[model samples]
Target: MNISISSDPQTIAENCADVIWAEDKTSRMLGITRDSVGPGTAAVSMIVGDEMVNGLDMAHGGLMFTLADVAFALACNTRNSIAVGNFCSVQFLRPASRGDRLTATAKESLLDGRNGIYDVTITDQSGRRIVEFRGHSKIVPGTHLAAASGDPAAAEV
Candidate 1:
């Protein structure tokens, strides 16, 4: 809720989209799509696929973690506040099968200037939680420093 500039929600979402779109398998395999971003809420959805499953035929922990991370990113980056994950921990509760649609919802728990915390949940098509993640992100000013440099590989933070 602390953006330096006031703008339409769509503009904020679009700017975040550019970052997500550039992600590789972590985003693609999880089927991550930004739903919306409001003052302090961010939603993202994903679908489980064969490529996202482990040998046990359930969604891989990494896939769930990625989806949760995406939600955390969007939630903490509200108002054009670029955020980077300082630390994240994911707990796997259940498992999801292939073809199951997954959605990760993240909401800001607290924000203190440049530091924010988020709680994210990953659920299956049936709305059963498969994983829960707690992420700590740091907000900073300006556009994504990596994208601004034009070298995405060097932007890994």
Candidate 2:
């Protein structure tokens, strides 16, 4: 969990996204991409691949969940604190198929002390809702990045 973060909020958010993409091999293999990251929001996308299809000839639930989870992780970690998901629930509305590009957008709904709630919406390229995910997170005591070299002010986000 030793990652390089930035003092700037936006840079910290971007660094979190980069760290996620670097650390999560499952997300990388699934073709997940971090589209954007902000203070309390993140967007991730992936194209449904043939290998990701399930027995039903549709995108597997696990893949969709991973995409949403990545977005949730990026959104929650923007504060430069190590945020771990405590609970999450996903509701599948429509099945996705190979060649479909899916996007998951996560927005923080509430944050109190170390606890937070995020809502993620997964949609197809056409903007059709595919899944809904709600994630609960808890911020831990450590910072994601160490202080930058020669810059005392670049401590944490």
Candidate 3:
């Protein structure tokens, strides 16, 4: 809302990501960090904790899915538009243990109208692939920045 970033598409995307990350309590709670963002791309990282593991002593599948989902959501919403995930699927390739740091990177593979497809790869600190996630996102009826500038009428779909 402050318009601190320039009008360049890349800058706008990064700035929009800042706005989104600031209020993403779920990511913050999971110890996730927004590493970098650009047009149609984003990377987030998190560490596995004791509570994040299942009885098998491995990281929960949901935890990895959520990491990839966060990256996908940020990648699609970089154009000032708000996007929500409609569907997603994850393939677990390996296991992760406690204290392991994992990074999820998202790249937009297709964007048609209000629908977009993203591919997210989750890797361990050693760069070994852990999960492959695909997400479908749908643009919603709102702007991330302009609508929050004290003008209620600016929030048109």
TM-scores, all candidates, are 0.76, 0.89, 0.89
Tell me the tens digit of each residue's lDDT in model 3 across 19-120.
888889999999999999998999999999999999999999999999999999899998888899999889999999999999999999999999999999
lDDT for 49 in candidate 1 is 72
Cα lDDT of model 1 by residue, 1-157, tens digit: 2212224555555555555456545666556777776555677887777688899998888777878888887777665556789998888998888888888888888888888889998888788988889999887666532233454433342
Q: How far out, in Å, is residue 95 in model 1?
A: 0.9
Report how far off residue 122 is in candidate 3 (Å). 0.2
Q: In every candidate, how many clashes are there?
A: 0, 0, 0
Q: Which candidate is the best by lDDT?
A: 3
Query: lDDT of each model, Cα atoms only?
Result: 0.72, 0.88, 0.89
Candidate 2 lDDT tens digits, 47-104: 9998999999999999899899989998999877889999999999989999999999
Clashes in model 1: which pairs? none
Residue 20 displacement (Å), model 2: 2.9
Worst 10 residues of 3 by lDDT: 148-157
- Model 1 off-target regions past 4 Å? 1-26, 144-157
Candidate 2 structure lDDT: 0.88
